[model samples]
Target: MRYPLLMRFLFLTFLLLCASLHADESPDTIAPIRERAMEHQKAGRFAAAVDDFIKCIEEGSKTNRTGRRAEYFARIAYNQTRMGNFKDARENMEKAPRQNGWKDEDPFLMEMRAIVFLATDQIEPALQIAQKFKAVNPKKAEYFEMVAQFFGGDEKCLATPLGRFLFDPEQLLYNGAVARNPKDLIARRRRAAYFLERANQQRFPNSYPAKIPVDRGGWAHLFDPATAAGLPYSFYASAFYDLSRALEMCSSQDEPFLRVRRAGAAYGWNAVAPKNSLFISAATIAGDLKRAQKQGALDVRTQRALGDFFSETLPPVDQPNYRPRLRSGIQSYSRALYFTRDESSLRDPDWLETPETDSLQKVRAARSTLIGFHLSGKPVALPDLPPLTELAWKDYGNTLVAREELGSALEAYKKALEFDPEFVPALNNIGTVYSRLGAFDIALEWFDKAVKADPKFAIGWTNRAGVLDELGDVEKSLASYDTALGIEPQNAQTWVSRGILAMNSKSWASGQNAFAQAARLAPQNSRYAALSAFAKFANENAELPKIDLSIEDKTWLSNFFGSDSLAESYASKGAADKVFAAREWIK
Candidate 1:
């Protein structure tokens, strides 16, 4: 009995030794490490993933699994590229084995090589690789080709039929992907982004006669004909639809960004052209025109055109049809805020402690990750959500402002400040709300804080100038206007405001110059033209120039001249100095 038991024990020991030896050469031995590496990659810890992938390659090499080792090498190279180690990525990519004795035949290896080439700005090689894989993986290949074309930035190439088909909104490649798979969040997001970019291009066409630069403050009242063209409602509607679908398909980690984007699209859809109103219409303006004519106001063909313009441009006189859409946007931003705030605790500690100066850089980094995922079919990790939370609150505040809920808008903006006290937009908006409420001193204080936070903020300076003007600090207001103009000379609205202040102060020459500049910047706006003419007449005591003044402008002048007929008589006589005496009523 003792000899039989010893024999059983020895047999078990021999089997265990053999199994251990087999494990060393089995692919299953690397499974745990591979899983860990994939987890690291999915979490955006590319450096850690690179190390694990290197270990996988080492283990695969021991098993003489050349194909598996090649895959591991490709993975390592991809992770290295994500980590911005381009040289290392290229070196590792070169280690991946050629398939069937052809270097470009292996789809996975080619993909890794193309990505590395793209990272290194080798657009031509990337394009070649993309073309080579066109038949093997058309979806990925098309994406690579599109990115290569974008990086190449060759106008001649983009003007070609193939390039137009690739980049044009009507023929976008993502449209096909989404059509094939409605649940493809990446395709939906990309299509939505494409529509938005197209809408922006339409809103600010390159062929526009006057190119008014967009202001830093993003103030809504800037007068630019290009902006007046407005983004087509259909574009935003399409974008909103795709974004809504993406939201339905996206994971919880992606919900915040998608929600924010959807909210923005909703806002754009609600705010675009074809003004919604229950009261104001062409009929109302026509009736008003008849009354003016009965009162002997000089009614001309331009008056009808002005009425049409007003009918089209004016905000709804009552609650708009799009209020529910604005409310929906508000709800989306609220949900985004909730998700971001709840997930903040899970963010890297270093991100939470990032300095205010680095906030923009962090946002750019998050955007770059998104761009990479969009172009390369890479899985993006959850980006830092806190910086975006501030944007959520600011945009929420803006929607509330659009809804005319000033009190709620203040609360939303204050919430934004809670996330980032130095957030310039929130601070500027708070000041704007206060100015609208007639609390000039408090508004000035907030504007001061905004400009102090970022001296280069032109909008903050402009807001400060307006508040100063209201508070009778004319010199300081003018200086602030000068600073804002120095920052953004193409801001026509600022020029108009500065001109109005100049005229009120009886600085006639300066008023004329500012008004002329505004008119030069916004040539399509007849209101600016009229203002310039009036300023010129007032400054030089010259004959009144022929300018198309809107009905509202004529009414303003009528109020000043004591009657519509008297104002017309003064204009007919070029008695501009007499008209200039009514400058006190300018505002």
Candidate 2:
């Protein structure tokens, strides 16, 4: 107690330092406020708890008390729910302060809000919010199921006309009726299948019923399980499968229309290329070519068919396989340098040798770099085409065309036509090339001559329609499309083209119908599926609110319904974007 002043000060400093090191740290400065809020919440003083939590959150916001901020927000949300303030709770939950790298806070809040809606029997709203949450975070499959169970009630809701046909509880009894009343069965089933297939076929493939979130009441399962199962190839497998079977099952007196129906189905499904947007199935085209070559005396129709096959079988527009990378010494040296270089600088030459490699690497480094360096606002310069000796000017013209020099392409085509005045393909190609360059008049002149020379050419009719459409002559364009369809009704692309024209003409009903028909013909087409959904929504009585046009159209249910209970109820458990996209068509 009587120690010297300096010794006492030194001893006190050491003691204070020791105490500071051993102090029980508060993770959040507002920890006491968070604890008080929880206590108030537990005592059923929800409003008081909310007030305290809000204060805590405000305090945390001022300071860097992240944990306390989240705790307060989470508590406030819970108390709001307990007080039966569903709307307030939803707002609070949605506005819950996000913590850097803090897991589960946002989703937990979303899940709680969904529960509040469910407690109040706001089934639709519950489903919509749950679906939004699920879409944002797909790993939570439970959220999807939660909404689906409510929308897809144990007994289907008898709300709409389609529901009467679709939500039949007495499935087994209906099956028995189909067997006994064969004619009626054929009629009903055919009509039912037609409508169902129409619904199934949309412009966007992702819009298929199956693609709808499982949480939205499993409506897609309607036809796939019951009605479609009775058909030849289940409608589940192919939308046209049941229609095809119906054609076979129907009476022989119905032969002519049946052929038309069958042909329509064939065109829809058959014309669609497998895998991607390839115009024709390579296997099928190859087989056709082999047959045509083997039978040298094939008829004109067969020859033309082969030509059509050739036209469609060309490589995809984006991923053209024409230019294979040289893969010569340039690539070998590049790889060799990578192995030899020990220092990063030495590897510089390896990168330099292969410009594409370095460019690709830069793209990988950052997408912005790729766009800035390679694909920015630069014009595409075409490489000169190798000279063709037959006619010097013609060769020059073709070289320009090959380089995507539109003017040059037109000039080349003209030169080629000058050399061989009766070259039908060249004339047709010239018209198409010119049409692409927006030279409608010139394109029309050439197309007219091509059609006159080859009256039965389907391409001429299709191409003529394209030019007509560009020229804003929709009615005539539609006529041309019809002419093309008459020659080849099974072409899905042509159906799509016609459907687009119809849509552009404000024939939403007919446009959707046409799109549906096209989708039925090609079940796997995503664009067709999406368009079909849009069409159905257009026809349906369900209201679609006018959302902001600036928002990116998701083409899915989750996006449309958003946090609304009814919207959530119909959203897909799996893909939300497609579901939101579909919702727009509802009104």
Specify the highest-TM-score model's number: 1
> Would you list the C-alpha lDDT of every candidate in the order shown?
0.59, 0.48
TM-score of each: 0.30, 0.29
- The clash tally of candidate 2 reads 43
**In model 1, what lDDT does residue 140 have?**
71
Q: TM-score for candidate 1, please give it.
A: 0.30
User: Which regions of candidate 1 fall more than 4 Å away from where they truly are?
Assistant: 1-388, 542-556, 559-587
Worst 10 residues of 1 by lDDT: 216-225
lDDT of 1 by residue, 1-587 (tens): 99999999999999988866776556576889999998877654566788898887777667644446777878888776554355677787777754223355878678777776755446778899989998899967876776565544433335566544334333234545554565667766776776555554455567333323322101010111123223354455456556655655677555544544444454454455344311112343344334323321111211221222222233442546333323222222221221232333222221223244543333334333322222232212222345548889899778777866676677778888988999999999999876664445567889999999999999999999987775556799999999999999999999998988887677779988998999999998877877777677667753332322222445534444445565676767767455645543342
- Show where candidate 2 strays beyond 4 Å: 1-399, 541-587
